[model samples]
Target: MDHDIEKAPSAPPTRRDALRVAAGLLAVGAVPLAAHPAAAYPGDIDVCTGGYDAEYEADLAMAEALFEAEEHRAFAPERPPGRYTLPLRRGFRVSARYGIRGDWLAGHHTGIDLAVPTGTPVYAVSAGVVVLARRSGQYGKAVTVRMRDGHYAVFAHLSRIKVRQGARIRAGARIGSSGATGRATGPHLHLEIRARRGYGSDIDPVRYLARRGAPLL
Candidate 1:
């Protein structure tokens, strides 16, 4: 996912160049962009509706069971305590869920996993103050937001942190980019909605997000 973006040339395209262009577009889910000239690619086949490419889908499945390990902790679960949008845009395909699964979580899986590209933009699920923004141990580069409800939200395995601690941020604000960090086996965002601003006190973020209008499974 880490690539050096280069300026594309406007010269006459070769067959190989055309295929590369088409592939790049498809991988980004923007193949046959309306703004692109139909004849730009070889064979003049105008791709429509962003056709699915097998490689792209497989490469982008949520990172290795959403990067989890056991953490036996107790929770005084509560409702969302507020509204929220999908932590990742375009809805989700949750790779890992809340609660203990003998496979991933030890006692309780605090958050839900939304596997995505390494540099996919991550938005703040709700308005809150950035309380913690640092390289947390197994969580990698993480951000903890103190929501207006006093409950907390965690965004982990980030490639870059976009906001600073103490910053008052609103829902949908760009907070960070997803990545394969900490104990992750692949690139994805580890999202947790907690009863407070720490581990060992987590709730079902899936149900919480759903109640808030974003139903993800």
Candidate 2:
């Protein structure tokens, strides 16, 4: 007589079995694991933490370097000389003389005004040091020429400055262009002869220049 063999019965999956299957599938879908720990972290966290491999880190470093370079560039101070030439050639017509406009806020016109075109070439009246060559709210673009006589000749309302500060200049040299700058009513040069003491006293430029052989027109 022969004996019969029995087959094992299949069992249905439980909740645990289903969960294990889902996890396996998820692991497979997330393939290509990163080699670095920073890559494993969230991108935003890496950036905020200054991660070297972060996308914007290089750009930030470059910007910082550029800013530093620009800061150093301005570190070199501008050294203007102590003197400059009188920025006018021939004698200019006087439109307003210094000390005559005392009613103006400037207390008094510390300089004489020369009537000229918008961009007339202004030459150095006398040779001296360029004590000042810069812009002022009232003087506009001005140049202060210190003469050998210990007096300061101020030329105001210029369009441009040709020489740098600290550079030596001769008489009749082109220093700047005439213009209506700094509280000017029109295109004119405000000239003033200040006695080294400052604004307290100023001599009449008209008679002074005339005596110096600058004929008044």
Candidate 3:
């Protein structure tokens, strides 16, 4: 009674086996699998294309919003009444009102004329930067300060000019002495509050000052 055992047949190589073979071939410097075509890869982006732009736009929007907020704070909403003062320290009279017809101006008086003594110290009505401090034709030695409320405070007919263009001025700070430097019958300080930069944008100076609890005639 002799017994003989029959051996099972070996399995064929699988996909895993083929992959392993390919890897082995590659390790051994085989060019067959190494030269196989593959889909192109774009490597320029540090992050996902959509993701980077979203973050960038979010940051830019945040910055713009912050700037707008700051600009609004700097120049919007009229300041409270009593926020300004009389340009002169002592007795002065409002000889003329805004919109009064005058030959000095093109057609009207653009501001209130305060008839103060000659050489009287003139002060800035509010904290601002001087945009104009020079000799003007009719304004004489003028000084115009741009206020925080986005309005302009123009002081004209100065005997002398103190601040220059681009100078920072404080509220009630002395700018110059008042006089009838240009065409005038008497010594006075001409004050104008414009909504914008120049004469065409001129608004009422007397009412504007009176509402602010300043000295009014």
Candidate 4:
């Protein structure tokens, strides 16, 4: 008697197994010359693998180059230390801060009010040119310094102004003496940091100084 035997078929190949086969075939140059020209172009070859696509390869290379350059490049240095200093050195108290809403002020306090003596020396926060040094309306004897950083430093309510208009001064140089020359409750320094050298361009003076490494506590 003759017996018939049945055989089990092999399992389907995984994607990885197919890739390996394809890679092996490629290694031996199994790809036919009749294949697409793009696949055979040298520029289409991947930097990491045998993948094809000239645009993709170029973009990948460019991305890698950019990343490498950024990793090794030196970052921009921060502003030098001691480049800025407080307008007042010591023995002063903050009577009023910026943005205080009151009926007396035009909507809000444009700058800070440091309660100091009538003749406390006020210095330039940074190297700058004096743009205004005269009786500036409600500001009284004010000195507006066009600072090196482009922001205008307005020292308002001053009793004495030492700097003249268009005069270049160094950082920490005495600009005037603080007093209640303008609208104020008592003898104090009204400091305003303005984007322009006029009224209504006021920014927070304390915050600006703090950013330049000078803080008023």
How many clashes (backbone N, Cα, C below 3 Å) per candidate? Answer: 2, 22, 1, 0
Off by over 4 Å in 2: 1-93, 104-108
Q: What value of lDDT does candidate 1 attain over all alpha carbons?
A: 0.57
Best by TM-score: 4
Off by over 4 Å in 1: 1-83, 103-106
lDDT tens readout by residue for model 3, 94-115? 6666675534322456677787
| TM-score, structure 3 vs. true | 0.59
Tens digit of per-residue lDDT, candidate 1, span 1-217: 1112233444544545544544553455432212211112223121111112233222211111111101111122223435576667754445555663332222445576676778889988887666567675567787877666667788888889999765767778899998866656567787878774323457888787777787666
Q: How do these models rank on lDDT, best leading?
A: 4, 3, 1, 2
Better of 2 and 4 by lDDT: 4
lDDT of 2 by residue, 102-197 (tens): 333234545566777778887776665565576754567877765545566667778887765544466677778888766566677767776642
Off by over 4 Å in 4: 1-82, 104-106
**Residue lDDT tens for model 4, 1-217:** 1111233445544545544543443444332222121112133111111112232223222332332232332112123323789999878877666776543223456777787888889999987656557774456677776665557787877889998765768889999998877445568887889764334567999889888789876
**Overall lDDT per candidate, in order of appearance:** 0.57, 0.51, 0.59, 0.60
TM-score per candidate, chains pooled = 0.59, 0.54, 0.59, 0.60
Error of 1 at 94 (Å): 2.0
Order the numbered candidates by TM-score, best leading: 4, 3, 1, 2
